[model samples]
Each structure stands twice: as C-alpha cells, then as structure tokens.
Target: MSARRIDRRGFLKTAATLAAPIIIPASALGLGRKIPSERITIGVIGLGGRGTQVLKDLLKLPDAQVIALCDVHPEHHREFENGKGPRLGSTPARELVDKAEQARSGQPGKPCFVTGDHRELIDRPDLDAVLVATPDHWHAAITLDALRSGKDVYCEKPVTHLFAEGQAVYREVAARKAVFQTGSQQRSDALFQQAAEIVRNGHLGKIRSIEVGLPPGYDKPMGSTEVKTPPAGLDYDRWCGPSPKLPYMNARHHRWWRGQRAYGGGVLMDWIGHHNDIAHWAIGEELGGPTRVESVGWTTPDVDIYDTPVDYEIACEYAGGITSRISTKVTEGTKWIGENGWLWVTRGKIKCSNAALLDKSFDRGEWVAGPTGSHVANFLNCVRSRAACIAPAEQAHRSITPGHLGYVSFSLKRPLRWDAKSESVIDDSDADQLLKKSESRAPWA
Candidate 1:
C-alpha cells in the first residue's frame, strides 16, 4: 500500500522561521489513521512487541512499506501469542503487515518475506530501510550491518548494548551519512519538545540541576531456575547471538531479557535513553557526555538469573556546569531546576514551576528548535528527504553514555572521570576496559 508522495514533510515554524511547535498535529500527514502511496521499502528485523508497535506506525506511513520480517522466534499461538507482547515473532508480524497492506490498498498486496536470520532480510535489494527492534545487545551489530548495506535504520532506543558499540554506531552513521533514528520517541512528542525548547531558549533562565528518575528492574526475576527445551518455534542459539550461551529459560527470552547484563543492561540502560535524552535535549547537549560520574546506594538482585541493580542512584557532573542525578528512587521523569523556575516532562504530560511558560510558546524566537511531530513519521520523512533525524546516532550514543558509565562506576563502586571530547575514562584502566564489550562479543564488538 502506498500514497503519492507530496511536499508536506516539514516542521511548524515560529515567527523567527525556526521550527516550533506544530500547530497542526502529525495526523495532517496521515501519521497512523490514514495511508498514502508508499515510497520507501522497509525490512523489519525483530517482530516482537516493540517491533509490532513500530510496524503499526509504519503501516500508517504513506511513504513506507514493510516488506520483510525476521525474528529468532516464530508464533506459537500460546499464552505469549504472536501480534501481542511476550512472543509475537516474525511469522505473526508478517500476517499483520499483509492485513494492513490489503486493508489500506483494498487489495491483497505482495506477501512479506519472513525469516529467522536478519542477514537474509538485509540481503534483499529492494529494501531502502530497516527497523531493528531486537534486544539491546543486537542493536549495534544489526544497525552496523544495515548501514553498511546502504539501508537507513530506525533502531529502538538504548541504541548500544555497551559503550564501545555506541562508538561504533556513531562512527558508522557519520561515515555513511545515512539517516538513522533511534527509537527515542520522546524526542518527537510536542510536549517534550516544548519543555526542552522552553529550557533551551532561556525561558527557565539558567539551570540549577536536573533530576531524572527511572523505574526499577523491568519485571519480576523470580521464575523457576529449571532450564528447559526452548519452544520449538524459537532458535535459541541465534537468540543468544553474541551474548553468552546459557540454557534456555523463559525469563531470559521474549521481553524479560533486560534483567541480565549478558543479554540486557537492566533498568539503567533500559530507560536511560528516554528521560536522559530529554535532559540532554533541554540543555542543547545532545552530543556531549558527562565530565564525571559516580553511583552509590546500589544493590543487585539476589537471584543468579539477574545481576542488574534493583536499587541505585547515579550522580553525574557535566562540563556545562549542570549536575544530573538519575536513580530508580526518584520521581520517574526529567526535571530541570532553574534559577527562575523549573520544568518537568514525562509521557503524556508537561509542567513547569512557572506555569506561564507552558502556554508561552517559547516563541520569543531565540531559535530553540528541536525534534517535532510523530517519532515514526519523523524517521520516514527523513528517510525520503535524506535529512538527519531528530534522534540521530551520535545523540543516541551520548544520551545513553551516562547510564553506561554509571553502570561501570556502580559495578566498581567508585567514581570515574570522563573526558567528554575523548569519550574515555581518565586515569582508570579498569573503568576504561569496561567501555568495550568482552572478547566474546567478537566481530560485532
């Protein structure tokens, strides 16, 4: 299904000709409710929960077509059914795409190719873009592959599994000059953009400090320790990929992998890209790293299946003179305390101590523009225009850097100094080594 490409892709501008709050919603361009002719062919490589959601967004894009699906696990029609959360792998995603195309075009469209190997999909010559919704560990490797293949990428957030991967991703995107959008959806929301603009344009005056709160460990890590045969539909070995091969456990697959460091980086890495990205956006520090970072009051789970901390606080000092504290124990949002007042933003809401700013439009026209419109639409629009996305690779790498550094500092129970320009830890060999993945991560690392 596709629509004739038009000239509507753009941002709402302010009186000064800078992109400002879009007075009209993204729906005017058919964000999700309508469909137009497609222009960009897409291959989707992880048909799990997040994959399905993003696929829904793709289905709505008039300039994009999802033509391929890949996942280690296929649908089993069980408790964790396909098209839903726990297991809706490749085959099911194929079904969904077909239905959407047919419904949008009023005719059965070309069938989507389904496979377990991502390399297979990337080999397709027609694909102009790839969506990577796999586990955090697979992000950099798959993204690197797609970029090398000349495919634009829309990878899910927390773009790198480890610090070195971040560097690799940033470098590759720059070298290729490919359009890459990290699934930092918050960047596309108007309220978040508004909040960041207000702070950025000096509407909040100078900043005092930032407090970012994230949730604790993702889900309960208390399943039975018994290892079992992986479901027949799952290719468990490929699922583990570069991560250490452990006996199959339901808790380690599907949506539960984040609790372990080997497969996922737990809550710290999980939510870091989100709230922290907003923090960086507010301050116009999208490509910068914290000068120093330390973590304290940290504790990990007792179960061997999980090693990520359940309780922790990370304090980071930046070269820009603003300090940020990120912890699961805080209020679960990004709050900027400024000299004049404060501004806070979370999903679906935005508030400020000086309430007038919320309605002020920050239109004093200092050109504090940021990402606007629907996140998914923003990526597709950039794909067609070959323009830089709202959340590009470097910003994604920088957004999650503090969290990765915090994890290392927390694991070592010490403070570490970071040289932002060099993107390395100073005077700490142990800390520096943690920046890269282990030897087992191999060619991908």
Candidate 2:
C-alpha cells in the first residue's frame, strides 16, 4: 500500500471522529520484549522545539517508532505533518520520517499518527510509551494521566510545580507500579557522571559547598502591548492549561516560558536542577530533600513580564553541615570545595585546588554503566525494564526543592526556616502557601 499522507488537521479530524473512551490494547501496541523488539510504538506530546528533539532521539532507536504526535498549536503540528516523507538525515525531522517509512514498508513496523490533543494519543492502544515535554505547569497533570492510563512516561526536568504535587505524583507512580523517568539528562553524559562519582567516592575530601551557575537573564523590560487575537489553528486555551489566562506574547508562548512564574520556576529550577542534582549525587544524598534554603539577590525592578528573580545566591543546607550555594550569574562550571582541595568541572574542562590532582587521570574501568548511553536513552530503557531511572520523579522533586525554596526566601526577603521532612516553611503561613499550586481558570481547572 502507498504511504499515508496524514497531516495535523487530518489527524485531528480522525481523532474527533473516534468515540470517547477509546481503548488501546497492550497486544496491539506490542510493548515490551524479551530482548529489544523489532518495533516499539510511541507517542509524542507537546511537539514544540524540545518535543521535536525528543522525537528525533526516539527515531534513532531501531526498536522505536513514533506512532502518534500531539500538540496544542496547529501550526507546530502542521510544520511536521506537511514535511516531506521518511528520508535519512542527521536532522530529527528526517530521522522521524525515515523511521515511519521503515515501519510502513513492512521492512519493520508502522507509520506514525499525528494529532493535536495529547489526550487522543494517550488513549491509543498502539502506543508503548508517551514522552511528556510540555511546560512545567502541565508536567504533573499530563504525567499522572498517562501513568493512570497505563503508559510508561519520560517526563521533563523539575517534574512538578509544587512540593505537594511531587509527593502526590510519587505516590501515584508507586501505587501503579509504572516506570517513570525525569528528564535530567546530564546524568547520562560521561563527564558529569565521572565528576559526580569522584565526589561521591571521597576523592574530593569532606564536602563543603557546591556552586552551580545558570545563563544570565534578560536585562531589558518587556513593554506593555495590546492583547491581540489568538492565532488560527492554535488552541490557546488548552495551551494555557493550569496557568492563568493572560495576553499571549511571543515570549510566553514559545521558548521564553522559562521566565514566567506560573509556567516555570525561572533559572533556579531550570538550570539548578542539573547542577544541584550533580551536587546531590556527589554528596551521596540523591534521594533526600535539602534541610534548608536561603536566597539573596534580585532581578530587574519590573514586575510585568517575569516575576522570578534574575540573579541570586541560594544556599541549600544538607546533613553533616555540607552546603551547596546555587547561583544564576556565576561563571559556567561546578565547583566542589572540600577540606583537602576543590575540583571545578565544566564541559570539556576540569580543574583542582592542587594542580597535581588534575594531572591524575581517573580510570573508566571503575565506572558503573548508567541507565542508557545518555539521559534520554536511559528513560527508554527503564520503560522496558521496569527499573528506576537515574532521576526518578521523587529525586528530581528533591533536587529542585532547594531552588524553589531559594526563590521563596528571596521573595519573602527573609531567611525562612524550612522543614525538609514536611517539605514546608516552618511556622510561616505565606511561605507555606507557596508550596502548593494555585487553582487555574476553568477548562484548565
């Protein structure tokens, strides 16, 4: 049979025609294999830039197929649906199409289906797993739904917006016995893993403090602009799910959502999660939350566009007097300070307090193989093995807690006492409120 030319609109029409409560049978999806299966049917949610990259990675695996793609933006979906059919190339788009064609030719599997609403794809019996790459606000809800629907999940970093939600998600995953992986991909990189292992093995001596850095924030203010009509084929309401309804701007809609408070926790949660996670791993406390957090710094004076602090020094106190100071404006590198010496690490570079330590190269033989060759690969493997991923939901939630707490301290303009066990601010009602998410408008509610 000739290859199907289903586009985003066509896929949505198909999904609409299908009745509610669609059931996707596990047998039809062909999930799980003794070894890697010939084909692993998968679904893609939130097909923006990150979603597209993930799609490419899935295509690279010989056993995987992108059976369904979903996004709220019709234009974004159209961009993929109207693209040329399967062909070989280094680009993700090419790889996805090529894999789809491979499945259809009877050479291996089946072509992918595209849709606008992720709910449609989640209900598909033909899917082995779903990748949740939506904004931070939507992460917990979408993931919980997917897990409840009996699909394994590979969710993005800083897994939840609030501490309580993280706990709820942890309970849900545990109860369902679903395989879940958080998208803190740095754990899969060779250099990062080596650095973390070195610190954990006590090569860095008694841990003192960790310094984590993030890219600088925007200096200019976002001037007021009139609210224009929502673009065609875009479900703005659905896109803003779990977030307050606000005038649509280029920054809020696309990649710049990181700066917004409702959608993201700014650089603290975005960059600190990776670096702080490194510190957590190195300290051998990867599963627990920090005992305390304090922040000192400020962003631009304007409060219109972004409410998160742009520059700040946040400290996470752990057990045994070890502390990690996560900063957004610091030079790009991780510094581990201990009693004997300090080790500094960044991509392609490593340094030590004693110059001689830098000369001593470590052996790879002592290294334990991580979940996958890299972070994303690890998630895929965990879905099949039912093994715990390197950065599971609980671990990621703890890793980001310091950053979130730091932001709270900065906002409150005081050194707030944090109860790590309770995951709440001690005795402070206002600070306590920040630990939970506010109700979104109707529809999102």
Instruction: Give the number of colliding residue pairs in candidate 1.
Output: 7
Lowest lDDT 10-mer window, candidate 1? 14-23
lDDT of 1 by residue, 1-445 (tens): 1243221123354211322212233344221312222467889988777888899888876666888889887775333534443447777688888998898899999888988999999988788789999998898789989988878899998998878888888899888777899999988787887888788878778887999999988445644456999878788778888788888776666677888888788888889999999898878788777889999788888777888888878899887589999988789899999899988899998888977787753352344455466687777766654568889999988998888888888878899999988888999988899776454444444
Note the residue pairs that clash in candidate 2: 24-125, 67-113, 86-97, 103-109
Give me the runs in candidate 2 sitting further than 4 Å from their true place: 1-38, 76-95, 98-100, 103-111, 221-226, 301-303, 354-372
Model 2, residue 358: distance off in Å is 5.8
Residue pairs that clash (backbone atoms under 3 angstroms), model 1? 2-36, 2-37, 2-38, 3-36, 3-37, 3-38, 82-88
Error of 2 at 309 (Å): 1.6
* Model 1 local distance difference test score: 0.79
> How much does candidate 1 score in TM-score?
0.89
Total clashes, candidate 2? 4
